[model samples]
Target chain A: DVKVTQSSRYLVKRTGEKVFLECVQDMDHENMFWYRQDPGLGLRLIYFSYDVKMKEKGDIPEGYSVSREKKERFSLILESASTNQTSMYLCASSLGGKGEQYFGPGTRLTVT
Target chain B: AQSVTQPDIHITVSEGASLELRCNYSYGATPYLFWYVQSPGQGLQLLLKYFSGDTLVQGIKGFEAEFKRSQSSFNLRKPSVHWSDAAEYFCAVWSGSSASKIIFGSGTRLSIRP
Candidate 1:
Protein backbone atom coordinates (compact mmCIF):
# COMPACT_ATOMS: atom_id res chain seq x y z
CA ASP A 1 0.00 0.00 0.00
CA VAL A 2 1.10 3.56 -0.68
CA LYS A 3 1.86 5.36 2.56
CA VAL A 4 1.65 9.12 2.92
CA THR A 5 2.16 10.54 6.37
CA GLN A 6 1.63 14.03 7.74
CA SER A 7 3.58 15.50 10.62
CA SER A 8 0.55 16.50 12.65
CA ARG A 9 -3.09 15.52 12.67
CA TYR A 10 -4.11 18.77 14.31
CA LEU A 11 -2.42 22.12 14.95
CA VAL A 12 -3.32 25.42 16.56
CA LYS A 13 -1.59 28.72 15.81
CA ARG A 14 -2.22 32.31 16.70
CA THR A 15 -2.41 35.19 14.29
CA GLY A 16 0.87 36.29 12.67
CA GLU A 17 2.64 33.13 13.79
CA LYS A 18 4.47 30.97 11.33
CA VAL A 19 3.08 27.47 10.84
CA PHE A 20 4.52 24.45 9.11
CA LEU A 21 2.83 21.25 7.95
CA GLU A 22 5.09 18.40 6.91
CA CYS A 23 4.32 15.45 4.70
CA VAL A 24 6.28 12.39 3.62
CA GLN A 25 5.46 9.76 1.07
CA ASP A 26 7.09 6.34 0.74
CA MET A 27 6.02 5.63 -2.83
CA ASP A 28 8.76 7.74 -4.45
CA HIS A 29 6.21 9.62 -6.49
CA GLU A 30 7.39 12.50 -8.62
CA ASN A 31 4.57 14.89 -7.77
CA MET A 32 3.56 16.27 -4.38
CA PHE A 33 0.65 18.57 -3.65
CA TRP A 34 -0.75 20.65 -0.78
CA TYR A 35 -4.48 21.28 -0.61
CA ARG A 36 -6.80 22.93 1.88
CA GLN A 37 -10.26 21.48 2.23
CA ASP A 38 -13.24 23.41 3.50
CA PRO A 39 -16.91 22.68 3.97
CA GLY A 40 -18.76 23.03 0.63
CA LEU A 41 -15.61 24.18 -1.16
CA GLY A 42 -14.02 20.72 -1.35
CA LEU A 43 -10.25 20.54 -1.80
CA ARG A 44 -8.40 23.44 -3.42
CA LEU A 45 -4.78 23.06 -4.35
CA ILE A 46 -2.47 25.47 -2.54
CA TYR A 47 0.86 24.43 -4.04
CA PHE A 48 2.53 21.53 -5.80
CA SER A 49 6.06 20.33 -6.37
CA TYR A 50 6.99 18.14 -9.28
CA ASP A 51 10.68 17.86 -8.39
CA VAL A 52 13.07 18.75 -5.63
CA LYS A 53 13.36 22.56 -5.22
CA MET A 54 10.71 23.05 -7.89
CA LYS A 55 7.37 24.48 -6.86
CA GLU A 56 4.31 25.79 -8.65
CA LYS A 57 1.50 27.93 -7.30
CA GLY A 58 -1.98 26.43 -7.24
CA ASP A 59 -5.42 28.02 -7.14
CA ILE A 60 -5.18 29.25 -3.54
CA PRO A 61 -1.49 29.91 -2.93
CA GLU A 62 -1.53 33.55 -1.86
CA GLY A 63 -1.04 32.98 1.85
CA TYR A 64 0.94 29.77 1.60
CA SER A 65 4.36 28.62 0.37
CA VAL A 66 5.80 25.14 -0.08
CA SER A 67 9.20 23.49 0.16
CA ARG A 68 10.48 20.29 -1.40
CA GLU A 69 14.09 20.06 -0.34
CA LYS A 70 14.03 16.28 -0.76
CA LYS A 71 12.13 13.88 -2.97
CA GLU A 72 10.31 12.03 -0.21
CA ARG A 73 9.09 15.05 1.74
CA PHE A 74 7.13 18.24 1.12
CA SER A 75 6.45 21.07 3.50
CA LEU A 76 3.78 23.75 3.53
CA ILE A 77 4.45 27.03 5.28
CA LEU A 78 2.12 29.74 6.34
CA GLU A 79 4.34 32.78 6.73
CA SER A 80 1.87 34.45 9.05
CA ALA A 81 -1.13 32.51 10.08
CA SER A 82 -4.53 34.15 10.01
CA THR A 83 -8.04 33.14 11.04
CA ASN A 84 -8.95 32.70 7.41
CA GLN A 85 -6.23 30.07 7.02
CA THR A 86 -7.86 27.62 9.38
CA SER A 87 -8.80 24.51 7.45
CA MET A 88 -7.95 20.86 6.91
CA TYR A 89 -4.67 20.66 5.02
CA LEU A 90 -3.93 17.59 2.98
CA CYS A 91 -0.77 16.33 1.30
CA ALA A 92 -0.84 14.10 -1.71
CA SER A 93 1.70 12.37 -3.94
CA SER A 94 1.42 10.84 -7.35
CA LEU A 95 3.43 9.59 -10.30
CA GLY A 96 4.42 12.13 -12.92
CA GLY A 97 1.44 12.76 -15.21
CA LYS A 98 -0.40 9.75 -13.82
CA GLY A 99 -2.90 12.02 -12.00
CA GLU A 100 -3.87 9.45 -9.37
CA GLN A 101 -2.98 10.97 -6.00
CA TYR A 102 -2.42 9.18 -2.71
CA PHE A 103 -3.35 11.37 0.25
CA GLY A 104 -2.09 11.66 3.77
CA PRO A 105 -4.36 11.61 6.82
CA GLY A 106 -4.49 15.45 6.80
CA THR A 107 -3.56 18.20 9.25
CA ARG A 108 -6.42 20.24 10.62
CA LEU A 109 -4.90 23.67 11.27
CA THR A 110 -6.74 26.06 13.52
CA VAL A 111 -5.51 29.64 13.15
CA THR A 112 -6.88 31.72 15.98
CA ALA B 1 -16.40 28.54 -14.86
CA GLN B 2 -16.73 25.54 -12.61
CA SER B 3 -15.15 22.54 -14.34
CA VAL B 4 -17.03 19.99 -12.31
CA THR B 5 -20.36 20.18 -10.47
CA GLN B 6 -21.92 17.82 -7.94
CA PRO B 7 -25.53 19.00 -7.85
CA ASP B 8 -26.44 17.46 -4.53
CA ILE B 9 -24.90 18.98 -1.45
CA HIS B 10 -26.26 16.32 0.89
CA ILE B 11 -28.21 13.11 0.44
CA THR B 12 -29.76 10.84 3.05
CA VAL B 13 -30.92 7.31 2.42
CA SER B 14 -31.94 4.20 4.33
CA GLU B 15 -29.37 1.47 4.91
CA GLY B 16 -30.52 -0.94 2.21
CA ALA B 17 -31.63 1.61 -0.41
CA SER B 18 -29.93 2.42 -3.70
CA LEU B 19 -27.83 5.56 -4.03
CA GLU B 20 -26.83 7.87 -6.83
CA LEU B 21 -24.73 11.04 -6.80
CA ARG B 22 -24.73 13.33 -9.79
CA CYS B 23 -21.71 14.96 -11.43
CA ASN B 24 -21.44 17.11 -14.53
CA TYR B 25 -18.50 18.65 -16.34
CA SER B 26 -18.05 21.39 -18.89
CA TYR B 27 -14.64 20.49 -20.24
CA GLY B 28 -14.30 20.60 -23.99
CA ALA B 29 -12.54 17.33 -24.55
CA THR B 30 -12.99 13.80 -23.34
CA PRO B 31 -11.82 14.04 -19.77
CA TYR B 32 -10.51 11.70 -17.15
CA LEU B 33 -13.08 11.35 -14.39
CA PHE B 34 -12.81 10.18 -10.78
CA TRP B 35 -14.91 9.65 -7.67
CA TYR B 36 -13.36 10.06 -4.24
CA VAL B 37 -14.73 9.44 -0.76
CA GLN B 38 -13.65 11.22 2.42
CA SER B 39 -14.68 9.97 5.79
CA PRO B 40 -14.95 12.40 8.68
CA GLY B 41 -11.60 14.04 9.51
CA GLN B 42 -9.75 11.90 6.93
CA GLY B 43 -8.25 12.56 3.55
CA LEU B 44 -9.90 11.58 0.31
CA GLN B 45 -9.77 8.05 -1.10
CA LEU B 46 -10.16 7.09 -4.72
CA LEU B 47 -13.35 5.16 -5.36
CA LEU B 48 -13.23 4.86 -9.13
CA LYS B 49 -11.87 6.43 -12.30
CA TYR B 50 -12.91 6.65 -15.94
CA PHE B 51 -10.14 7.36 -18.43
CA SER B 52 -11.42 5.64 -21.52
CA GLY B 53 -13.14 2.57 -22.96
CA ASP B 54 -16.04 1.31 -20.83
CA THR B 55 -18.54 3.80 -19.46
CA LEU B 56 -19.59 1.84 -16.42
CA VAL B 57 -16.80 1.48 -13.84
CA GLN B 58 -16.80 -0.43 -10.58
CA GLY B 59 -15.19 0.97 -7.50
CA ILE B 60 -14.31 -0.19 -4.02
CA LYS B 61 -16.84 -0.60 -1.19
CA GLY B 62 -19.74 -1.52 -3.45
CA PHE B 63 -19.66 1.78 -5.33
CA GLU B 64 -19.73 2.28 -9.11
CA ALA B 65 -19.92 5.11 -11.60
CA GLU B 66 -21.04 5.52 -15.18
CA PHE B 67 -19.51 7.93 -17.64
CA LYS B 68 -21.77 9.57 -20.21
CA ARG B 69 -20.05 11.58 -22.88
CA SER B 70 -23.12 13.15 -24.40
CA GLN B 71 -24.50 14.38 -21.09
CA SER B 72 -21.08 15.25 -19.73
CA SER B 73 -21.85 13.30 -16.59
CA PHE B 74 -20.11 10.79 -14.34
CA ASN B 75 -22.51 9.78 -11.61
CA LEU B 76 -21.67 7.43 -8.76
CA ARG B 77 -24.03 4.67 -7.67
CA LYS B 78 -24.40 1.90 -5.12
CA PRO B 79 -27.07 -0.77 -4.86
CA SER B 80 -27.12 -0.90 -1.05
CA VAL B 81 -25.83 1.48 1.53
CA HIS B 82 -24.25 0.55 4.80
CA TRP B 83 -24.00 2.85 7.81
CA SER B 84 -20.27 3.09 7.19
CA ASP B 85 -20.94 4.52 3.76
CA ALA B 86 -21.79 7.94 5.17
CA ALA B 87 -19.13 10.34 3.94
CA GLU B 88 -18.41 13.24 1.63
CA TYR B 89 -17.98 12.35 -2.05
CA PHE B 90 -16.13 14.42 -4.61
CA CYS B 91 -16.00 14.22 -8.37
CA ALA B 92 -12.84 15.28 -10.16
CA VAL B 93 -11.77 15.79 -13.73
CA TRP B 94 -8.55 16.01 -15.73
CA SER B 95 -7.43 15.21 -19.23
CA GLY B 96 -4.32 14.49 -21.31
CA SER B 97 -4.88 17.75 -23.16
CA SER B 98 -5.47 19.81 -20.03
CA ALA B 99 -3.11 21.03 -17.36
CA SER B 100 -1.70 18.76 -14.67
CA LYS B 101 -3.97 20.04 -11.93
CA ILE B 102 -7.24 18.17 -11.46
CA ILE B 103 -10.54 20.02 -11.03
CA PHE B 104 -12.78 18.82 -8.20
CA GLY B 105 -16.42 19.39 -7.49
CA SER B 106 -17.65 21.01 -4.30
CA GLY B 107 -18.62 17.54 -2.99
CA THR B 108 -21.74 15.76 -1.79
CA ARG B 109 -22.15 14.71 1.81
CA LEU B 110 -23.86 11.35 2.19
CA SER B 111 -25.72 10.40 5.36
CA ILE B 112 -27.23 7.04 6.20
CA ARG B 113 -30.62 6.94 7.83
CA PRO B 114 -31.49 4.37 10.46
Candidate 2:
Protein backbone atom coordinates (compact mmCIF):
# COMPACT_ATOMS: atom_id res chain seq x y z
CA ASP A 1 0.00 0.00 0.00
CA VAL A 2 1.17 3.50 -0.80
CA LYS A 3 1.87 5.67 2.20
CA VAL A 4 2.32 9.37 2.88
CA THR A 5 3.74 10.56 6.16
CA GLN A 6 3.84 13.97 7.80
CA SER A 7 6.58 14.95 10.20
CA SER A 8 4.21 16.11 12.89
CA ARG A 9 0.57 15.37 13.71
CA TYR A 10 0.17 18.40 15.99
CA LEU A 11 2.29 21.46 16.46
CA VAL A 12 2.17 24.66 18.46
CA LYS A 13 4.23 27.68 17.53
CA ARG A 14 4.55 31.21 18.77
CA THR A 15 3.59 34.17 16.67
CA GLY A 16 6.27 35.35 14.20
CA GLU A 17 8.10 32.02 14.46
CA LYS A 18 9.22 30.21 11.38
CA VAL A 19 7.74 26.75 10.83
CA PHE A 20 8.36 23.82 8.57
CA LEU A 21 5.93 21.03 7.78
CA GLU A 22 7.44 17.97 6.15
CA CYS A 23 5.77 15.40 3.96
CA VAL A 24 7.24 12.24 2.49
CA GLN A 25 5.66 9.82 0.08
CA ASP A 26 6.87 6.30 -0.68
CA MET A 27 5.28 6.29 -4.12
CA ASP A 28 7.15 8.09 -6.88
CA HIS A 29 4.30 10.39 -7.67
CA GLU A 30 5.05 13.23 -10.06
CA ASN A 31 2.93 15.81 -8.29
CA MET A 32 2.83 16.96 -4.66
CA PHE A 33 0.50 19.44 -3.05
CA TRP A 34 0.06 21.43 0.15
CA TYR A 35 -3.33 22.57 1.34
CA ARG A 36 -4.76 24.27 4.44
CA GLN A 37 -8.20 23.25 5.64
CA ASP A 38 -10.48 25.43 7.73
CA PRO A 39 -14.04 25.35 8.94
CA GLY A 40 -16.61 26.42 6.31
CA LEU A 41 -13.94 27.37 3.76
CA GLY A 42 -12.78 23.78 3.18
CA LEU A 43 -9.35 22.87 1.88
CA ARG A 44 -7.61 25.65 0.00
CA LEU A 45 -4.50 24.92 -2.00
CA ILE A 46 -1.37 26.71 -0.84
CA TYR A 47 1.16 25.34 -3.28
CA PHE A 48 1.97 22.39 -5.52
CA SER A 49 5.03 20.93 -7.15
CA TYR A 50 4.92 19.02 -10.39
CA ASP A 51 8.58 18.12 -10.55
CA VAL A 52 11.69 18.23 -8.46
CA LYS A 53 12.79 21.82 -7.70
CA MET A 54 9.72 23.19 -9.45
CA LYS A 55 6.80 24.73 -7.58
CA GLU A 56 3.63 26.61 -8.40
CA LYS A 57 1.52 28.90 -6.28
CA GLY A 58 -2.04 27.92 -5.52
CA ASP A 59 -5.04 30.00 -4.54
CA ILE A 60 -3.92 30.75 -0.99
CA PRO A 61 -0.15 31.16 -1.19
CA GLU A 62 0.26 34.10 1.12
CA GLY A 63 2.58 33.54 4.11
CA TYR A 64 3.36 30.04 2.80
CA SER A 65 6.03 28.57 0.56
CA VAL A 66 7.09 25.10 -0.56
CA SER A 67 10.22 23.20 -1.49
CA ARG A 68 10.60 19.92 -3.36
CA GLU A 69 14.25 18.93 -3.19
CA LYS A 70 13.55 15.25 -3.91
CA LYS A 71 10.79 13.46 -5.73
CA GLU A 72 9.68 11.68 -2.58
CA ARG A 73 9.70 14.67 -0.24
CA PHE A 74 7.90 18.01 -0.19
CA SER A 75 8.09 20.66 2.46
CA LEU A 76 5.81 23.55 3.42
CA ILE A 77 7.36 26.58 5.03
CA LEU A 78 5.69 29.32 6.97
CA GLU A 79 7.93 32.36 7.08
CA SER A 80 6.17 33.93 10.01
CA ALA A 81 3.44 32.10 11.84
CA SER A 82 0.38 34.03 12.91
CA THR A 83 -2.85 33.27 14.70
CA ASN A 84 -4.78 33.34 11.45
CA GLN A 85 -2.53 30.61 10.06
CA THR A 86 -3.69 28.06 12.57
CA SER A 87 -5.38 25.24 10.70
CA MET A 88 -5.03 21.66 9.50
CA TYR A 89 -2.38 21.31 6.87
CA LEU A 90 -2.54 18.40 4.45
CA CYS A 91 -0.01 16.98 2.02
CA ALA A 92 -0.89 14.92 -1.02
CA SER A 93 0.89 13.18 -3.87
CA SER A 94 -0.42 12.01 -7.20
CA LEU A 95 0.81 10.76 -10.54
CA GLY A 96 0.63 13.08 -13.53
CA GLY A 97 -2.72 11.86 -14.71
CA LYS A 98 -6.36 11.70 -13.80
CA GLY A 99 -5.37 9.63 -10.80
CA GLU A 100 -6.53 9.65 -7.20
CA GLN A 101 -4.37 11.46 -4.70
CA TYR A 102 -2.75 9.87 -1.63
CA PHE A 103 -2.76 12.17 1.39
CA GLY A 104 -0.63 12.23 4.49
CA PRO A 105 -2.08 12.38 7.95
CA GLY A 106 -2.64 16.11 8.41
CA THR A 107 -0.58 18.35 10.64
CA ARG A 108 -2.71 20.51 12.87
CA LEU A 109 -0.87 23.75 13.58
CA THR A 110 -1.82 26.03 16.41
CA VAL A 111 -0.32 29.47 16.70
CA THR A 112 -0.29 31.19 20.06
CA ALA B 1 -13.15 28.35 -13.35
CA GLN B 2 -14.28 25.03 -11.89
CA SER B 3 -15.86 24.71 -8.46
CA VAL B 4 -17.68 22.18 -6.23
CA THR B 5 -20.49 22.56 -3.73
CA GLN B 6 -21.63 20.27 -0.94
CA PRO B 7 -24.98 21.67 0.10
CA ASP B 8 -25.41 19.94 3.42
CA ILE B 9 -23.36 21.29 6.30
CA HIS B 10 -24.40 18.52 8.70
CA ILE B 11 -26.52 15.37 8.60
CA THR B 12 -27.62 12.93 11.26
CA VAL B 13 -29.07 9.47 10.73
CA SER B 14 -29.79 6.48 12.90
CA GLU B 15 -27.95 3.23 12.44
CA GLY B 16 -29.35 0.97 9.69
CA ALA B 17 -30.90 4.00 8.00
CA SER B 18 -30.25 5.00 4.41
CA LEU B 19 -27.94 7.92 3.58
CA GLU B 20 -27.42 10.37 0.79
CA LEU B 21 -25.09 13.41 0.41
CA ARG B 22 -25.48 15.88 -2.39
CA CYS B 23 -22.68 17.44 -4.43
CA ASN B 24 -22.99 19.99 -7.20
CA TYR B 25 -20.25 21.29 -9.49
CA SER B 26 -19.80 23.81 -12.27
CA TYR B 27 -17.37 23.31 -15.10
CA GLY B 28 -17.33 24.15 -18.74
CA ALA B 29 -16.32 20.75 -20.08
CA THR B 30 -16.71 17.26 -18.75
CA PRO B 31 -15.64 17.13 -15.12
CA TYR B 32 -13.85 14.47 -13.14
CA LEU B 33 -15.53 14.04 -9.78
CA PHE B 34 -14.40 12.45 -6.54
CA TRP B 35 -15.73 11.76 -3.03
CA TYR B 36 -13.47 11.60 -0.01
CA VAL B 37 -14.03 10.82 3.67
CA GLN B 38 -12.00 12.25 6.52
CA SER B 39 -11.95 10.99 10.06
CA PRO B 40 -11.26 13.37 12.92
CA GLY B 41 -7.73 14.78 12.77
CA GLN B 42 -6.89 12.48 9.82
CA GLY B 43 -6.28 12.90 6.14
CA LEU B 44 -8.97 12.53 3.55
CA GLN B 45 -9.50 9.08 2.07
CA LEU B 46 -10.75 8.54 -1.42
CA LEU B 47 -14.19 6.96 -1.34
CA LEU B 48 -15.01 7.01 -5.04
CA LYS B 49 -14.26 8.83 -8.28
CA TYR B 50 -15.95 9.29 -11.64
CA PHE B 51 -13.86 10.21 -14.67
CA SER B 52 -16.03 8.85 -17.41
CA GLY B 53 -17.88 5.78 -18.61
CA ASP B 54 -20.57 4.49 -16.26
CA THR B 55 -22.27 7.08 -14.10
CA LEU B 56 -22.87 4.86 -11.08
CA VAL B 57 -19.64 4.02 -9.27
CA GLN B 58 -19.28 1.78 -6.26
CA GLY B 59 -16.72 2.52 -3.61
CA ILE B 60 -15.27 0.95 -0.53
CA LYS B 61 -17.09 0.78 2.79
CA GLY B 62 -20.39 0.05 1.08
CA PHE B 63 -20.60 3.52 -0.48
CA GLU B 64 -21.70 4.52 -3.96
CA ALA B 65 -22.22 7.74 -5.96
CA GLU B 66 -24.20 8.59 -9.07
CA PHE B 67 -23.12 11.25 -11.54
CA LYS B 68 -25.84 13.22 -13.29
CA ARG B 69 -24.51 15.41 -16.05
CA SER B 70 -27.73 17.26 -16.65
CA GLN B 71 -27.96 18.37 -13.05
CA SER B 72 -24.22 18.69 -12.54
CA SER B 73 -24.61 16.59 -9.45
CA PHE B 74 -22.78 13.59 -8.03
CA ASN B 75 -24.59 12.30 -4.98
CA LEU B 76 -23.22 9.69 -2.58
CA ARG B 77 -25.48 7.07 -1.04
CA LYS B 78 -25.35 4.02 1.17
CA PRO B 79 -28.03 1.43 1.87
CA SER B 80 -27.40 1.37 5.58
CA VAL B 81 -25.64 3.74 7.91
CA HIS B 82 -23.00 2.57 10.33
CA TRP B 83 -21.81 4.29 13.44
CA SER B 84 -18.26 4.12 12.21
CA ASP B 85 -19.24 5.98 9.08
CA ALA B 86 -19.66 9.26 10.93
CA ALA B 87 -17.13 11.66 9.50
CA GLU B 88 -16.65 14.61 7.19
CA TYR B 89 -17.27 13.99 3.49
CA PHE B 90 -15.86 16.21 0.77
CA CYS B 91 -16.67 16.46 -2.92
CA ALA B 92 -14.01 17.54 -5.37
CA VAL B 93 -13.59 18.10 -9.08
CA TRP B 94 -10.64 18.43 -11.41
CA SER B 95 -10.25 21.39 -13.69
CA GLY B 96 -8.78 20.00 -16.90
CA SER B 97 -5.95 22.10 -18.22
CA SER B 98 -2.19 22.06 -18.28
CA ALA B 99 -2.14 22.61 -14.57
CA SER B 100 -5.02 20.19 -13.91
CA LYS B 101 -5.77 21.55 -10.47
CA ILE B 102 -8.33 19.92 -8.21
CA ILE B 103 -10.86 21.99 -6.22
CA PHE B 104 -12.67 20.71 -3.12
CA GLY B 105 -16.10 21.46 -1.75
CA SER B 106 -16.82 22.89 1.67
CA GLY B 107 -17.63 19.37 2.99
CA THR B 108 -20.54 17.82 4.85
CA ARG B 109 -20.39 16.44 8.38
CA LEU B 110 -22.12 13.08 8.89
CA SER B 111 -23.34 11.84 12.25
CA ILE B 112 -24.64 8.34 12.90
CA ARG B 113 -26.85 7.67 15.93
CA PRO B 114 -26.68 4.33 17.65
* Predicted candidate 2 versus true structure: per-residue lDDT over A4-51, tens digit per residue: 999999999999999999999998888899999999889999999989
Instruction: Compute the lDDT of residue B8 as modeled in candidate 2.
Output: 98
Candidate with maximal DockQ: 2
For residue A109, model 2's alpha carbon misses the true position, in angstroms, by 0.6
Q: List the residue pairs that clash in candidate 2.
A: none
lDDT per residue for candidate 1 within B48-102, as digits (tens), equals: 9988899999999999999999999999999999999999999998735222567
TM-score of each: 0.96, 0.98
Model 2 CA deviation exceeding 4 Å by range: none
* Residue B12, candidate 1: C-alpha displacement in angstroms: 0.5
For residue A97, what is the lDDT in candidate 2?
70
